[model samples]
Target chain A: MASIVRKPKDLIAGVLFLAVGIGALVLLREYDMGRASRMGPGYVPAVISGMLLFFAAILIFRSFRGPQEVLAAIPLQAPLAVIAGVLLFALLLRPAGLVVAIIPMVLLGMFSISRTGLLSAMLTAAILSAGSVLIFVYTLGQPIPVLGYWFKG
Target chain B: MIELLGNLQIGFATAVSLNSLFYCFVGCLLGTLIGVLPGLGPAATIAMLLPITFGLDPASSVIMLAGIFYGAQYGGSTTAILVNIPGEASSVVTAIDGYQMARQGQAGLALSTAAIGSFFAGTVATLIIALMAPVLAAAALTFNAPEYFALMVLGLVVSVVLAHGSLIKALAMICLGMLLGLIGTDVTSGTERLTFGSNELADGLDIVAVAIGLYGVGEVIANLNAPAEQRTAAGKAITGLLPSRADMRRIWAPILRGTGIGSLLGVLPGAGALLSSFVAYAVEKKISRHPHRFGHGAIEGVASPEAANNAGSQTSFIPMLTLGLPSNVIMALMIGALTIQGIQPGPEMITNQPQLFWGLIVSMWVGNLILIILNLPLIGLWVKLLTIPYRYLFPAILVFCCIGAFTLGNSVFDVYVMIAFGVLGYLLKYLDCEPAPFILGFVLAPMIEEYLRRSMLLARGDPTIFISRPLSAVLLTLAALAILAVALPAVRKTRDEALVEE
Candidate 1:
């Protein structure tokens, strides 16, 4: 293993937990932690954050000694694209509406796959947009708008 | 016995109505559809389906939702047996022996064994619920804040016992869940605790977004990260759909044992089908004449867990329906659906809304029967579904989840929450951390805080009230024992070896 990165699994989990614990401690720093009899919003959280640090410490300690399971770095392309695609849809849904918003989302998702032909990707995008309109807009009567403000009344 | 039959008769009358039946059919079909899909779990499905329940009457909505829960259990085993992947958490055990059975060309027998075993278990569990709920509900009536607090404490400890791997990590995860649950405005103080001034934070995190992001989106990411060679093809092609005569005889005992274990544990508020299936698998392996056959296509492996999980799914409802405390995320969604209809789902359900209660109970049996028909004959359709590439499949699920989150409050902020958790879920998977305990922790955290406050108020700030009461004392003792037992090195080592990851 490289000197810079040791046990990734335990290391990552420990770091994650530590950050959460410390962050929570800071966030609840000012809230009134009432007595045990009548606890405030911060009481249970403070106690939990303390325990989080305890467990996170053990995990970080174990990283130096325990055997490794996953040493390889995680692949990032799929998740980033997928999450970004969904975010884009959410961003565009109200302003551009389902019909226009869905196109970019489907196109971005298909682009991540990288094997499908460009024409079919567009074809699939068109099909998905129509299906979304049919199911969510026409049949289910879900409150989503079909067209953007430019097209609608 | 006569009273049980009489109540069932009323249930039958209410459930057999056209509206209830239609919704039951929809729930079962939708459950199976999502179950066969690799990334979506029943909890996510139910959470995503929450908006649909807004318009329906309480009885029909619940009946359908209950059908979806068990129906998903049945569908999950199908994927486990065919492909090596488990479709849900409880089906993780089923994959070990089930995939082996399929590889050995007994895929048909494995699927049929699962179908028959699940049907048998579901029918019996439904009967158990009918017999036990009223009396159990009556007992629950006497429970107070101290008793409830103790019970939740026991529930959390039991959750630790059920989790695989390190007990410390499980405890930590539960604690983290409670911390997250504490976000949003404090109901008592009228002050926002973790909401950093955002109006969206006022009501706390949207649960459906969190659940789907963790289970649905996290699963897709994990599948993507899996080595290509390990993704293994679904076992050849399904052949005959019936087990050998001797096979049936051998399975009956394991099925019965599984049902007993499931029904017993499922009634516990925090434990559910996931716990039952694991215990059943371990017990079957322990008692088997050939324990080595476990990962090598043992029919008993498939039979026991399939039965146990379906039974666990049914009995898990007992605590939820009776106490209004959800045993799992799915039931939590059921509570969400009911609360949307202006009904607080607790002990009063049986006494005040008998139609909704009884109809839901009866609809479960009908749902099982419908599942049997769907699995046995429609096996080919599911096989067709199995061939769809993950590339095409995952994006659709992602899009649906986005829509589902948005529909909850028609807000973009909830969509952001789902994405954030989706990334968090992947990080946990990288650490070999299991999401099951985290989920249980998340669901129970809000209630734990509420109960602790009330109990303390009643006791006039004396913490001893928890131990001074008889029932609470007993429950707390069990929780303590659970912790102490796991702290033992020998027990911890054995548990790490026993658990199977999905």
Candidate 2:
């Protein structure tokens, strides 16, 4: 009730949409805005960006009048751990291969689970890596190297 | 009728093959497995499994993918009943009465009710598809650029109307999706637009990457954000896998009514299955004389929504099959699957890829039959699977997602794209904006632009061509009405109330 913005979630979403709309418009500013009969590469995008800005404006305006809406706390640890695991897997996949890439990803991802011990995490990582090799490599015949350059070299 | 029979003959012939049958079984099984688990949804699972279908023929791949969708509907009810956790949005209502029945030690009866109801609904839905898809496709065949453009507009608008949050925000999400979808080289002019001077941006964002990132990796982060807890099955043991004769008498009406509502609603462009179940649940509660018993172990509550969700899932395929328009995210992924297999889904598919189209329809019925066996006699297996903690379950899912993104083009860059979307998806969730409209808008963007551009060319820049043509005019008018309806105060209140039940 004390906050100036009535609906916090709406405020954030509106701001995000407005930024994206402006960014798109700025990016496509140099491109040709061809006639309706023949649209340039930028034509449809600019129109869409304009529409986005319009909607964003309405949302922002509405945010001032609506009953208060509370935004949920964004989870930092869980997403970060999961994203880190995936990123590491991606980075290691070609260089370190599937086996090398999967283990760390699984291990790092275990941090998302509260009160988990090292033994269980390592077990899950080992089992998951083995299973990934069996399924993605040998069975599915995905063209991924099982052992990365680090191991082969 | 004779033509319908002929088409069905082709469908059964293709669906009955050992290859198709085997893959169909695998898809239903895997789909059920994911559905029984709390965290994974059909969209994410299908996205993760997409690379696996690359080696298969188009018909088999689509059949398998479709199997996953409806199969999840069946498996979702199992978790809802046993563990008080609906596996997906469609099953959220199912958890209410279904979990109550389970707590009353009637888990067997509830499970059987769901299975029988879903099977009956699935059969009717399959037949409806066989009968209606050809006609719908024929109707769509008459559409030109202006009509298609208008229809896409209506689709996006309807999706926004059906979404559960702020109307303007959903529309904004649609525009954002369209804008993002326009990245990379422009199809008509053959010029790179939004690459930010990157080589990977040349081909545009990969559909697989976007889907997996939004639904797969993004969802995992969201689930992990929730407090962890071990889930247990309701009641000590399951028994009496068949409903009594009296229970059956009570359930038949709800199942039939639910199937009818679901079939009608599922053909619309939105989260048709999810909406149908909620609507069906509300309808049942309204009509039942003993409505007070709804949340307290009422068998009607379990039967109606289960049947509605299954039927809704089945009929949601119609729009995708006939118009090449995805009614929801799963259908979007199905279109992605077809595109990967070098097939363009449209009215012409019936003529050009009849085997794939007809076979997919037939395989749904076959998959339903398999689901009965999986859910009834094999119910114990799924109950055991419910015991697998989320902590152990999520890592495997993450691995699959990572590898799936990597395999899309065998490039690590695609994985990076997935991570970025994952963050965006989480942010959108925090802002209470649903991702469904955004995804549908993304999938339809290029087509919308193409149709709009072509329509202008046909009319020589006379925008009235959309209004001048009767069909396109009607479609656009409907779209306008949908927006106006949402903007109306009375309709807005009812819409908010409906979603508030969740």
On residues B174-290, what C-alpha lDDT tens digit does candidate 2 reach at each position?
998888888888889888888898999998888778888988888888888777654555436899889889998999999999999889888888878888999999999999999
Clashes within 3 Å, all models in order? 0, 1
| Off by more than 4 A, model 1 | A1-8, A65-70, B228-237, B243-247, B268-271, B285-296
- On DockQ, the leading prediction is 2
TM-score of chain A of 1: 0.91
In model 1 chain A, the worst 10-residue window by lDDT is A1-10
Return the DockQ of model 1. 0.64
Candidate 1 lDDT over B404-464, as tens digits, reads: 7777777879888888888988878777787767777777777888889999989889999
Least well predicted 10-residue stretch by lDDT in candidate 2 chain B: B227-236
Q: Candidate 2, residues A1-153: lDDT per residue as tens digits?
A: 557789888878999999999999999987888999888888999999999999988888888875676766776987888888888888888888888898888888897667889999999999998998998889889988898888876
Per-candidate interface DockQ score: 0.64, 0.84
Interface RMSD of each: 1.5, 1.0
Clashing pairs in 2: A96-A148
**Model 2, C-alpha of B55: deviation from truth (Å):** 0.5
